[model samples]
Target: MELFFFQLLNGLGLGVIYFLLSVGLTITFGLLNFVNFAHGAFYMVGAYVTFVIVSLTGNFWLALLIAPLVIGTLAIALEQSVVKFSYVLEHKYQILVTLGVALMLQELVIMIWGPIGKNVSPPSSLAGIIEIGDFIYPKYRAFVIAFSALIAIVVWWGLEKTKFGALVRAGSENAQMVGLLGVNITRLFSITFGLGGLLAGLAGVLAAPLRGADPFMGVEALGIAFIVVVIGGMGSFLGALVGGLVVGVMQSVMSSVWPEGASLMVYAAMAAVILSRPRGLFGRA
Candidate 1:
């Protein structure tokens, strides 16, 4: 039972990482109708940025603050130069362009940060453990849970209740119609992409202490994010959240029970879900 609980906690932590990374993917898909394949690379860049900032200042908090801003700016440039070309290209071309960019970004990360990975410690204040009866949990993990929950709520509220959210919903459903109403949908798309990049960056920064920083981290994280997006139904916010948690918990639990099959299990589960309902749990057909 204790082990189950521990795995559950671990799943939730990982799920939040998925959620943060996928939210941007979800929004970009939902709004721009762009199938972004380079989202994971954004996550990796954020982690590397955090490492660089921390190495220079020895302040984790400062890295947390600056990394996202820097990443967002860089992402905007990538969009203007590379990603924007996909707007008129066929979907296949878009995928090819983005995938190529992802590969190039990975190589760039290796050149800039070197091929070696680094383990980053949580702030000293977050190093202890907390007890619940006989169960003791690392305080840093607890911190992850709290931070992720806060972000989820804020995102949910922003998307579901605000005027901006309403505009996004309307624009996504019918960009041409929204543009006819005098809304500059191209501008909206830019903002959506920028916001998505920042969210991914924030997720990367949050993950740095727990997972360490590495160029390869982005590739793996992107796969998890892709799974989450697929499971939840592309473009559906609730789907992303529910899918992330479900996949996260299942993978953690399965890894504990059968290490060899851990990787295949999650993909198998996704296959099952897709077989049962072709459009995903919340996606449109």
Candidate 2:
């Protein structure tokens, strides 16, 4: 029973990571109708940025503050220079261009940070454990879960209750109508894309201490993010949250029981979801 509980907690922590990673993808796809295969590149950038900042300042908090901003700024620049041109093109073109961008970013990271993975230690405050009765839990994992939940709340409130959220929703539904109403739909897209990149960067920073920083980390994360987006429903924030948690928990439990089939379980769940609800749990048909 204690083992199950421990695995459940670990699963929730992993789910939080997935939610942060997938939410950005969901937002970009939902509002911009752009498939950003390079989103994970920003994630990798964030982790590397955090590593550099921490190495220089010896402060995890400082890295946390600056890494996302740097990645977000880079994302905006990329959107302006490269992504914007592909927006009017077909999906195949978008995929090819974004995949190329991702490859370039991965190589850039390898050139700058080396091919070997680097470790990031949690802040001293978080590098401890908490005991609850007979079980002990890592403090950093708890922090990840709480911090991610707070972010999820803020994102939900902003998207569902704020004026900017309304504009984004409106733009996503009908860009022409929104443009006719005097809104700069292109600027909105830029902001949305940047925000998505910022979220991915934030997830990367959070994950660095646990997962380490590597050039190929983004590739692995991108695959899981796609599965989460599909299982949750494309462009659906609620779906991302639910699907992330489901996939996280499923994988965690399977790791303990089946070990080798852990990853397979996620695909199985996705297949089952698709067979029953093609649009995803919270996705609109």
Candidate 3:
């Protein structure tokens, strides 16, 4: 079952990327109760940032460092200028505003990078493959798995152990009370939004070499992220992780057996999950 193992590895790699993307969306929704339809567009921007930086300096590592930071700043600015106004509105209104933001960012990317997709090569250091017995794997992909695992650990620690994480959890439960305690809820919202953007950006950067950067990739990424979030349950950290892996593995395995129906299977899986548990696997009632 070398083939199965290969696909499994692929799935895990993809799952981590999905986890990174969905975790940000999950956190923002969990805390601010704000729906960010533009989350995917922010992800696209980060990929573009990596694309641009690598094209200019020929340094994948530098792009990796800078792309997320740039997106984080942009997200913070957008929150202060636009997203903050929607916090008090209904979810529908929030969706509309964020959808508008997504469209704007998509068009902006097209204007700058054109509608064509661009490829990003892995760094020379990770350009080769590792072989064991009869199996082989890409070095960059191996790096993705290890690096993402490290990130996941750091994120868990930050959320469960840090003061900021406590405040975030507290804010999610009772933002009004948190504000009553003089926690500057407005600033927290901005930071939370920025954090979401940062994670989305990081996912984009990591995914660029594997999938490349395209104007429409954000839309697809958004759909996948939503699927993961829905399957795992919104605002549930563990749900996001498990759901991402499940989706990733299913898609990867299906690709070999039913290439055309691979995407359909993801939706089918979601449907199956919904038919049984309406609130999602981990969503609160």
lDDT at position 25, candidate 2: 95
Quickly count the clashes in candidate 3. 0
- Note the Cα lDDT for every prediction shown: 0.86, 0.92, 0.93
Per-residue lDDT of candidate 2, residues 141-186 (tens digit) = 9999999999999999999999889988887688789999999888
Displacement of the residue 271 alpha carbon in candidate 2, Å: 0.9
Q: Which tens-of-lDDT digit does each residue in 223-282 have in candidate 3?
A: 999999999988888888888999999999999999999999999999998999877899
Candidate 2 local distance difference test against the native: 0.92
124, model 1: CA deviation in Å? 1.2
Q: Alpha carbon lDDT of residue 117, candidate 3?
A: 97
TM-score comparison, 1 vs 3, better candidate: 3
lDDT of 3 at 8: 94
Estimate the Cα RMSD of every predicted model relative to the unseen true structure: 1.2, 0.8, 0.9
> What TM-score, to 2 decimals, does candidate 1 have?
0.96
Query: Model 3, poorest ten-residue lDDT window?
Result: 233-242
- Model 1 lDDT tens row, 49-153: 888888888888888889988877777778877887788788788888988888898999898878989777787888899998999889988888888889899
Residue 93 local lDDT, model 3: 99
